[model samples]
Target: MPDILAVLNGVSPAWFLIVAGLLAWGAPWSPVRKALMLIGPCFALLAWFATHETGVYGVIDLGPFQLETFRFDSLSRIWVLVFILIAFINGVYALHERNRMTDGAALIYAGAAVGAVLSGDLLTLFFFWELTALASAPLIFAAGAPMAHRAGLRYLAIQVLSGVLLLAGAAVWASQTGSWGCDAIGVDSAAGVMLLLAFGVKAGFPLLHMWLPDAYPKATGVGSVVLSAFTTKLAVYALARGFAGEGALIAIGLVMAVFPIVFALVSNDLRQTLAYALINQLGFMVVGVGLGNELALNGAAANAFVGVIYMALMFMTLGAVLHRTGTVKATELGGLFKSMPVTGVCAIIGALSVAGVPLFSGFVAKTLILSGAHYAHNDLAYAILVYASAGVMELSVLKVVYCAFFGEARHHQVREAPQTMLLGMALAAFLCVYLGVDYRALYELLPFGIDDYEPYKLNNVFGQVQLLLGGAFVFALAVGFKLFPLKSDHTILDADWFYRRLGDGAARWGKAMGELLVHAINTALTAGVARLRARLFNLFNPAGALSREFPSGLMALWTAIMLAAVLLVSYFSPMS
Candidate 1:
């Protein structure tokens, strides 16, 4: 095969989206919509393949800033290709959803993600970053429930704040450094810190993570699947691009790895549980980024690529459950294997992938990250990651699988997921297994080479199996003794308490103070008006002295007395 340079040298992948968006707009509920949804990715993929070399495609000089819209380097290629692949898979999954709002949002959201990854400058990245936020928020609100509305608002606030921070950081960095390139920016300067924070918010770092679980579970089924595919992964890609070697990320990653397990253990909603589990998995990638070596960076990239697939798989499976049974709560969902076998099997595959079982994509990808930690002699991070890996099995694999599919029947029978959803799940499932068995393809696409790392070695497989099976056995015992957390509808208090509770309290206090201020102003105005009215009545009434015949003489005497008093005061004044 000839290299991409020999065939089509300078092509812009973003323009293909215009065709897709136009096609989607032409028909609201026609067969053309489905065709556009599927074919759009194909056009993008063709564009992506046509460019084999790394070069800037769309460059515009804006006097003070040079905006490079398309940067086809190794780092961007890995991320953008997976994003396009995800868009196609998501399109397939959402094919059954005829809601034009969701369909349009998904396409726009996908385009924004592609635009962000391919951007070569901070200004361009900021533009696409905000577009992703603005485009994806509607997916959550499309559910049209009260909770969805509230969650969408919260999601919008956090995402927009991230964009604002990005713009601010970009301006500062450009002003200080006179460069707009999106390169590694360690948090040594104010601009770097601001950029780090901007990336941190979207990457769902420890304190900033509440929005993911809070909003994702509340979105419509198809909406949830679309939401799962893009935002956080894009953040991960940003981190890989900007802050890969910062030692601070190791501790951040460790905390990120372990912190969400508690919430996942106690979560009653399967979607919420999976959302927390997604955080746990992100921890590993963050750790990899912290390690800063080629192997570790490759590992982070590979994990992010595979993570998008598996997490979307899990969300898609449960989303199908929610669609068919009207609920995804563990208490309300059980023995679903008897009815929705296809979904159940797909969920199991997703579970295995997330739990990092051998021969699944998670195993291959997560190994590189952990191995990097171990090789770096960061024993603390290694230990935490190992423990967190087991915890992942407990919450995501055992709890999710048993609670939703393997237990006694608790509801009326329901049919299997639609053919379209199954088709989507099958594509993800094939990738999960294929990437595991043939991981070289994944590694080859990594930002770095993988010759030094071997995931399928006997020793690696043995250790992974030992930890995973041991965790499984312990989880089984815990379940037998009824030691696992019971189901409840109450929302768990998290870092969100800072916002949800304290913020709400502050808002209420401010509102009360505002009301009191308004009341005080009204009272003062009312009293002043009353006094003015009394004086007016006294002076203007028909009984006043001015109405009498001697009014002129009395008025002259009063004026003379006022003039004498003023003169007396002026005589006593020191300046006068």
Candidate 2:
């Protein structure tokens, strides 16, 4: 009974979301929605503080099957806490949404996400992994546009594919190992590759990243916030659990970090640029996991934790711009600092955090990953990562802040964001500062020990500053030299090109082939039946004769013969 009570206590945080989803569904546009939004996170915070480092494991026995385990360790707690916090802030931010369906979907999405991180067994993790997809699809649909509907379908398809892969890998591992434990699998096996592919798809690893730009811009402000927090990070967590240190991930991570910078450089849409940037940032975490050292693992986990904040901050800032100025296109927006000072400042803070500027959350978190890479003695990987870091400063953090908020005013008399939105952004911004300054606490929560990490080392600080300054100088030089490429009217080809254009093309071709087959079959059947009828008619009626006259003559001759035979028979039968 006491054990049951403890489990209930540990899971209490999840119930808040359950309650919020129910209220959002049943209640109308009232304070109840707002209350549920605020109350949900408050309960999560309370639960996080109350739950201790007990290292307790809950097990359920199943005959002939592996026992189901639900355990709380230091490593899982960090992610769980972050998931809870993000869910709350996202809920508050989404309060401006008029659609109850969006609110409800966001809550369920949050719940499933939190559940995924807290899960202890592979089977449990798989269940939450799929639930997240089911819950988040509605948010994409809530955009209330035809494009959004199509994008939602595509997004759902990809997410389902990822889930299917995860389940298949889990099933294979269970059958081979006779355990459903969520531990690292050997990279030599098919199950490991399947798991990697599953995580890769979700992590937006290189070519698999199409759904991000396709779906994020189509989501509502609140929807974007929810979307940013769950899918990729969950995939990262799964990788950390199942395929950390796999050699293939190193190459995959490098591709992820480098390719997106080029797209972000040339792209005009601010939101899409950010989406590309998100993939770039995820590469750092992937590299850390591939390194497979303690510091590297810690770095990966820390990156996941901090990535949530910065990603949310970026999304919120962009979402605010879309809400106030009515668009997020770089060509359409300029100089919003005149009126929306709060939003402008918040956006800059977000930019700094993402850029890894000193004393921001990103600086502390990203350095750990880079340092881990160095510690692992993968100098080539480290060098590539350094270049990518400079690219991050150039493409996104600086470009977005300067172009969108610091230039000439494009709109006059624009108002600030709503109070709830501002509050949410402020809270996230505050956490960014808090995490940056008190990184020691964050460090301690990492999955691996990092005795050698010194965030304020002279070489580290100098290199980061040099990179940031160099990136800025390059940007200025490009502008001064008139080397900045003109924004093209055409869409840059990306991984989604194959799926969207090629997939659509394939569908059209299939339809055409099907139509041709149907036509050909119908023609052949008609011809065959016509030929058969003609042959039958010819056989019955004869081709040349219109009428037959021999039938009456033959009938008369036969009757005469029959009469002669009857007479002969009567004469012969006289004796009778």
Off by over 4 Å in 1: 1-9, 22-26, 518-576
Residue lDDT tens for model 2, 1-576: 455445556554555675777687678875677678778777766766666654544454666554333356766777777888888888777677678887777877777777776667777777878888888999989888998899999999999898899889889988888777888885777887787788789999888999988888788777887898888888888888777887778888888889888887767777778888888888888888888777778888988898898888888988888888777777777788777888888888888788887788888888987887887889989999989986554556667776678755675557888988888899889888888888887888887767567797788878888888888888877756867653544468888999799989999999999999977865654463556545545666665462342333334556787999999999789684
What does the lDDT read for residue 541 in candidate 2? 64
Candidate 2: where are CA atoms >4 Å away?
1-8, 54-69, 486-490, 518-576
Candidate number of the best lDDT: 1
Maximum-TM-score candidate: 1
lDDT of 1 by residue, 1-576 (tens): 356434445565655654585568567665777778888887788888888788898887898778898999888888888878888998898878877777777777888888898889999999989988988898999999998999999999999999999999988998899888899988988999999899999889999998999999999898888788788888888888889889999999999999898888888888998888888888888889989888788888898899999888988998889889988888888898999899889989988998888899999999988888888998998899999986554566577878888876887589999999999999998899999999989998998776666788898899889898888888888878888786566678888888888999999999999999977865654463556555655777677644343333334556887999999999888982
The lDDT for every candidate, in the order shown, is: 0.85, 0.78
What total of clashing residue pairs does each candidate reach?
0, 0
- Error (Å) of candidate 2 at residue 74 is 2.4
